[model samples]
Target: MILTKQHLQNNFAKARETNSPYVFVGIKAEGVSEVIVIPKKSFDAKEQFYMNAYSEDLTHVMNNNVMITGLSYGDADQIPNII
Candidate 1:
């Protein structure tokens, strides 16, 4: 799926309203974009730790640098970056 401005707006609003992190994973296959939004207080430390480790492993395996960006509620204009 392609990430749209509206998608960003909604997710960022959700993040701000719920005071939680808006997380999405972009897969590099057929230009597919996968978005997964976990609710507030649902992503605990253990999951976070495993996610971080998995991300690191993917980075090493793919030999690509991973970039994590923090977006404010008003920064929904970052459509290109997300796509």
Candidate 2:
């Protein structure tokens, strides 16, 4: 299903309650932008996952070079980077 901000918030809330990760795929109305959420360490992991997945082409990048940090419910930029 298509996910809005509210839908994501609600899903995150539920995920917090269950202590589980919420993972999904989203496509914006523009149709040009798409997103994919994976399990990270924080709530915003969803956005980060989207950004990391969106920012670069995986075909050229090495899999080992990619790091899956935690998620933050707020914003993807708000999360600190860790090695």
Candidate 3:
């Protein structure tokens, strides 16, 4: 998902409000595409489950939820510093 500047700002604000330690950052060919503030460790543990979910499935699963999925699992190269 391509996130607009406002979307990022909102996510950051949410992260601050919730006092989250980690945020899911998605990177595409162009640059960073999305940011999701994961609110549950259980959800983070199911990374593969979220990774395999289709976009439409993600839309349904993420309805009224803080966790957003469907980011490419293999996009690690995009952030060499983090790796």
What are the Cα lDDT values of the candidates? 0.39, 0.41, 0.39
lDDT of 3 by residue, 1-83 (tens): 44333443454455456655544544332233454334344334444454444243233233423333323122234233322
- Worst ten-residue run, lDDT, model 3? 66-75
Q: Give the TM-score comparing model 3 with the true structure, all chains together.
A: 0.34
Model 1 Cα lDDT, one tens digit per residue, 1-83: 43333443455456656665444433343334433344345445423443444343233133244322222222334334544
Cα RMSD, each candidate = 9.1, 13.0, 12.7
Q: List the residue pairs that clash in candidate 3.
A: none
Count of backbone clashes, every candidate in sequence: 0, 10, 0
- On a 0 to 100 scale, what is the lDDT of residue 79 in model 3? 35
Summarize candidate 2's per-residue lDDT along 1-83 as a digit string, tens digits: 32234444565666566666544443332224334454536567654444445423221123434322322333333233210
Over 4 Å off in model 2, which ranges? 1-3, 28-35, 45-83
Best by TM-score: 2
Give the Cα error of residue 16 in candidate 2, in Å.
1.1
Ranking by TM-score: 2, 3, 1
Candidate number with greatest lDDT: 2
Off by over 4 Å in 1: 1-18, 29-31, 49-81
